[model samples]
Target: MTTYRFSTGETIKHVVLILGALVVLLPFYLMVSTSLKAPQEIETNRGGFLGQQEMMVDGDCVRQGNAEEDCRQRPVVYNYTQAFEKAPLLRYLLNGVIVTVSIFIIQVVVALPCAYALAKLRFRGRSLVFGAVIVCLLIPVHAIALPLYIGLAKAGLTNSYAALIIPWTISAFGIFLMRQFFMTVPDDLIDAARMDGMSEFAIVWRVMLPAAVPALLAFAIFSVVAHWNDYFWPRIVITSSQELFTPPLGLREFKGEMADHAYGPMMATATIIVTPLIVAFLLAQRRFIEGITLSGMK
Candidate 1:
């Protein structure tokens, strides 16, 4: 039997990681605290994580304030309503869904076939083709943003979904990630499927896909987070379209509308925008970790 022990250096590394975690958590703590606080307290940035007392429960809430220390006893929804009414938040959410889902759908369509061919087939220049895909990963989006915008303009796709969808539909990151995942599939299983007369498409659709659930879920998490939080591209491509605003864009617009910035409402809007991504990441995190581990092994 063999025993292994971590070095003093390893212990130092662990302490550093813990310190890094606290650094990461402090901002999140402040944001959630700001969300739950009385409007005045948020403006002053004086609230704690759960905030000053008795303001919230699982059910019913009451408006707080107006007398000496009466504000702590009850809380208000006025800030939240002001935020929502001032902006078309529901439309923003819907546009986000439309753009992200559309991009994800297109990525799946393009990535699977490309991954399948690279992993399981031997065509002329197969290695070369795969290398090209890998090279695309090194090329940043900003490198080609100008050309894409110009191309979209030429095609009359500017200020429309086409401009958004066409530029990001098949992500280079998706291809590289999927190709790495596909390589990890057992060669014997693939060989057996071939011996049993399964076509390439059949094997991909049935056998390979069922086994790649972890990777798919992981990719979904990646795709959703990136597109949902995206602001710069939409800002560039979209013009004169309040209805087309996504959450991040909508939040900026909300900030502009207030004669005086309402810290509580801004924080509340931010909190609401963040919650879905957190829930999504939590649900997929287990599979995402496993999926990413598999890719690294490949």
Candidate 2:
């Protein structure tokens, strides 16, 4: 005995949101579709969604004098196999884990205390220091890239893990986000901690940190995604080190290395690279939404 309906504006908003989602997801669909398709299907753009998935012969296997029977495999299998076999995909994945984890850990260590101080402490020039952090948020990474690269080069730190990790140790946005979240926390909690003989450091770690878990999860996603997908800075600093190449840099293997570009395997590699982030976001989706909603409540 109940009827539900949307108003005209609400219906229009829903339609627009659905269209925007399709636009965002279309590239991912094509990447996954192409990864499953044969080269002929890809070139012709004939595959529907999952592709024909017909058996295809790998040219490299045949060129290496393998039997035709042995060389024939399904397009999906060929593409994924070539993705891992064509480069040190596992090594690149490990490097991504290392760099992203390192940067996140360092950023949390630095940002949490800075956020705590900015939010809780009343000291001289506190507003000025906080103003500086806000200013830093406005400065784009590209604006400071040359100076950071040159400083690293001068210090003989280029091509090392330090080069990757050091530049991102202090994240201004992380500090800002955590500070805003901390402002929403009750001042009584800090006073209680101080009554318990807890120093400022202890207050930050014990009092502020536990309450900031949602915000930290939100920051972690941002830090990990940015560093994991970063190719430009890594390309500049790790020019000579293949061992140090992140997942994004590893895609270069399929670009111009072979006589013919391996679009299927390249797409497969991209799919592989993006899978973890998607899984992570799904797992943290609730907390991420909660964090964003609660962060600006002050």
Candidate 3:
């Protein structure tokens, strides 16, 4: 039998990576486990990961004048059913998709041309524009929230889908990332396209855009995940419009409305809200990593 051993440094690195994985996955484990558990089990913290699956009487059903037999249910069923019944979760999910997709599409439209210009075009103040993009990257979204809100309010755009998406349409990080990736493209390609009598706009769209697919995919993942899980911004802009609530905002509102006894359902709501990004990341993980790696190489 062949035997192999890792070096001491490699062993330590492996240990650290394992620990980090556990730290990241811990919350997901807790959310799903809590969602599966009964209210009593969650409150007492008694059940193991899968819970006992014992049938329990729902006190809320009894309070609403249902018979004891009708109120009996397994914890998992109770939690998931309550999650759907207590809130318009499907609508919130749809809104999340709409807002995230809109933001990503608009961000690409705005960022790509700017990124291409910064990378390929030669003009005065080009460095200044690039420097401004870098500076914008350093500014957190929260810092400009008040000003953005005031402008939206002034325009009567508050509580609209435009309010959710318009502010994120210009992503400085997207521009910076794409610009770096674009810099790695050979000037030979641009010259060849020019030889074909293609305009600068045509080169940007027909040539550069296709080449930047991997980087664009990477940016799409970043933008979608950020906006999908964003609660604070939605809350700030979407007051008085329950219809405009995204998944995170809807989940927050659900938690606030529910009593302490409804912790399972709340966790279930969270699980529903968080599952899409996890699934999407798992599906595109290899591409996402490749994109990040290639973009950074320049």
Which structure among the candidates has the greatest TM-score?
A: 2
After superposition, the stretches of candidate 1 with alpha carbons farther than 4 Å from their true spots are 1-23, 44-76, 194-197, 283-285, 288-298
- Top-lDDT structure, candidate number: 3
Ranking, TM-score, top scorer first: 2, 3, 1
What residue pairs clash in candidate 3, if any at all? none
Q: How many clashes show up per model?
A: 1, 0, 0
What lDDT tens digits, residue by residue, belong to model 1 across residues 1-298?
8886979998999999999999998877776676566665666666556556445321112233244333233433644654576678878888889989999889987888788788878899989988888788778888888888888878888778777778887676777777778899988998899999999888887888788777877787667777898888887777667887788888887777755546656777787788887876688777656544543542
Candidate number that wins on TM-score, 2 or 3: 2
Q: Which of 2 and 3 is ahead in lDDT?
A: 3
lDDT, residue 197, model 1? 99
- What local lDDT does model 2 show for residue 143? 86
User: CA lDDT of each candidate?
Assistant: 0.74, 0.87, 0.90
Worst 10 residues of 1 by lDDT: 56-65
Question: At residue 193, what lDDT does model 2 achieve?
Answer: 91
Q: Could you list the CA RMSD of all candidates, in the order they appear?
A: 5.9, 3.1, 3.2
